[model samples]
Target chain A: MGGAAPAAGAPLVGANSSGGSLKALDGRVRILATAAFALATVSFSHFGPLLIALGGAMLVARLVELPILKTLRRIIAMDMFIAFMILMLPFTTLGEPLFFVFGFPASRQGLVEAALIGLKANAIVLMAMALLSSFEPVELARAMGRLGVPERLVHLVLFNIRYIDLLYRELHRLRTAMRARAFRANASWHACVSMGYLIGMMLIRALERSERILQAMKCRGFTGRLYLDGEERIQRLDLVFAAAFAAFVGALTLWEILSVAAL
Target chain B: MHIVDGALTLPVIAVGSAITVAGIGLGLRQMPPEKIPAAGVLSATFFCASLVHMSIGPSSVHLIVNGLCGIVLGWAAFPALFVALLLQAIFFGFGGLTVIGVNTANIAVPAVIVYYLCRRGVVRSSPQVAAIWGAVGGALAIALTTGCVALALSFSGDEFIPAAKLVFFAHIPVMAIEAVLTAAAVYLIRRVKPELLDAFSAASPDLQPVLAAAPEASLRSTQS
Candidate 1:
């Protein structure tokens, strides 16, 4: 949760960091970071003997002081239900009986499995945190394009990230206004309904705002395709970074393969 | 409520992806030129709405005003939402690539439902009636979407039912919050930007003129 504050509060870490050395290092470093991310994600999913390794990798990546973990904490806040899922996994899975309380038995295997699952989930989450913290939203959208995501899709994402804050501010103002008007009530469902209507209003405003924004963009020559300033050149450093990250992933994957083959 | 990759079955993801692509194609084909900007704003609004979280009891949930989206954008909301979710997946990784279809469907279906309901005069006719219907409809949409995602996950052989139950229950307070939020938003737009309603009404056949007389009176007063 501590990780989430920086991204949510600052909101421009990725976008504003596009200067000089940071700009130079952006592509290469992001490539390495994303490679680490992919490894971390795949490792988390398997979570057999690889839990400790994935966790270690995540901790090391976090130590790199990237903003990834912070942003991730904010995003993962939406998954509160997963907390209950984690809590139940240890008590429900089938396994050898390890301990008993009253008539219920705790399975050792279940505990171990659940612990691994937790570690894996956290590792994947941390990896995501790191990537988002380091890469600008626009850069990421561009990268997705390079990776074959559709042009219209990329445009939509860029605009969405750009204008999200405006909608939030509008909602906040409206809510404050409502409260000022003494729109208070008891715990009746009607009060709830009132709130829903307010949200609906926010959506309507958002639509109008988007229309204005689009007209603004069109006035400035925004075709369906997004055009970034400056030419994108893949440098020697980028190749080296990509190669090094690939080698690291390849080595770890080989080790995992050998370990499993040996068994 | 965005499902990550490797959480559900491959077949489920494949089917979901196909459906999402088809929906996007359909949405794109039907989008009016003037509405493109509105779609963009809705996309941004969806993105921004997910950021404002309020704690509900032991858990927290963010707002997703798909009902307003449906009412305003009609079928175009699907493509707009797809773009937003895709950004969320890549930029934030909230939802993974594999489940983009499932997540989009989960959110977009409610927007579509709200769109249709608004057309049917379930809302947009009377402020009081709209408020009540909007609240219940918003709650039902969130629940139904969550249920669909859960069912999809369960069919994929993941331990999804219990997780879904927990999610659905936790959402009870949040949904109520969302309901209030939606209703108030509608009421505000009704008061301040009444002409916007006319535009929406013109665009969407379902949203008939509820306060046609009020707008005319306001217009007459301004002219005088």
Candidate 2:
């Protein structure tokens, strides 16, 4: 179980076992991407035109390097939630009715509103997918640190990402064990209740395992601080990329603000 | 409730993140070295528990065994929960990194509450009682968390409220399923692996009443 790859159905971002290359993008690129995403989110709520533009930008950006199939897989779960939202919009929103489904009136304004919301949601999700796929977890932690995120928070994020998959594998084994025992929850509520008990027992076991790992780390001279190699240095190109990205976002934001003020 | 990215107001996420950090600090400070393995196992349990989905309405929802964690680990449940959630975020994308704090707090708070409640005998004293309490705790935790998450999501955009309501309603049956699973899990441990109860006993001496009350309680509760 220790050396096994992530399970087939598992989420893709943290499944990279070998800890893929750090700095998949130079400092400038990283900064640019971050700024672009930030701007995209902020503008999303206000201007419809900007939202469309950002959506196109994300669509193009995602299409360039990422496999279409992989991107589609990532979006699959999100699509469910988005669909649900679209379905509810016609029922809940107060606006002009466009059509009737059975006895219920479907609002034209609500449908438009829902479509826009879905678009915004997908854009944000795509941006994040791009960021997570391109950047290593450790590098992201460092970037957060450089941006003045608290050290403790960064450390927590790092440890959490690093060990999460190990926990998942452990969970898979436990589920198999439960199934092997013919402990089906459908049998009775009583059986289901016992499943919770098993969960409790598993939690206790996890604590014990984590404790041993921490002790081993301590023994190996792991102080509170995590030290990386010299390769983590920020290059000049990174700075240039970040500057250009920031300028673009600043300009977009300025345009949105001016447009709003005019209205 | 795992609040997805772009579903919550930035302020709520920001504040939630701060609160989550504080909770982590408290959890770390309180957690002893020997207990870390137990936390990891609990995390694994959480992951596994969620995977065993019980089909209800149009969709299936998995159990969240936070109550059992609360019963055993107490405050340590926070960090343990944090680990489980982080993994869920990365592997399943159940929640996003930005909303980690909110999700962690939503689950951890209930676990802690159940722990305190179990000690007070607010739950029954038998293994059956433990099971029932575990179920109630588990179900209530999920419901409450989902509600909170829905509220947070609503603050982000106009469409958020409707989306949140759909999710909240969808989770109702799942919450019941979780309750049943949590109860059965407790009962099995009492019958087969009694040592698992050792952690709970260590955390609170008062649990003896519950252990002693198990046989008669199980009989009465099961008969009823």
TM-score of chain A of each: 0.76, 0.77
DockQ of 1: 0.27
Highest-DockQ candidate: 1
RMSD list, candidates in order? 7.4, 8.9
Candidate 1, residues A208-257, lDDT tens digits: the string is: 67667656765775445446545666777666655765665566566667
Residue-wise C-alpha lDDT for candidate 2, range A164-223, written one tens digit per residue: 556666655776787788766553565655555556556556556655775676567443
| TM-score to true structure, per model | 0.75, 0.75
- For B1-224, candidate 1 gives per-residue lDDT tens digits of 77665455667767777877876765654333334466666667666666655554454556676666665556667788887776555445465554678888878877777766664454356766755665556666677777777777677644446666776776666666766666666666655664544443344322323322243343334335
Runs in model 1 deviating more than 4 A are A1-9, A12-40, A43-49, A52-64, A67-81, A100-103, A176-194, A228-230, A259-263, B4-6, B30-34, B53-60, B82-101, B122-133, B173-224
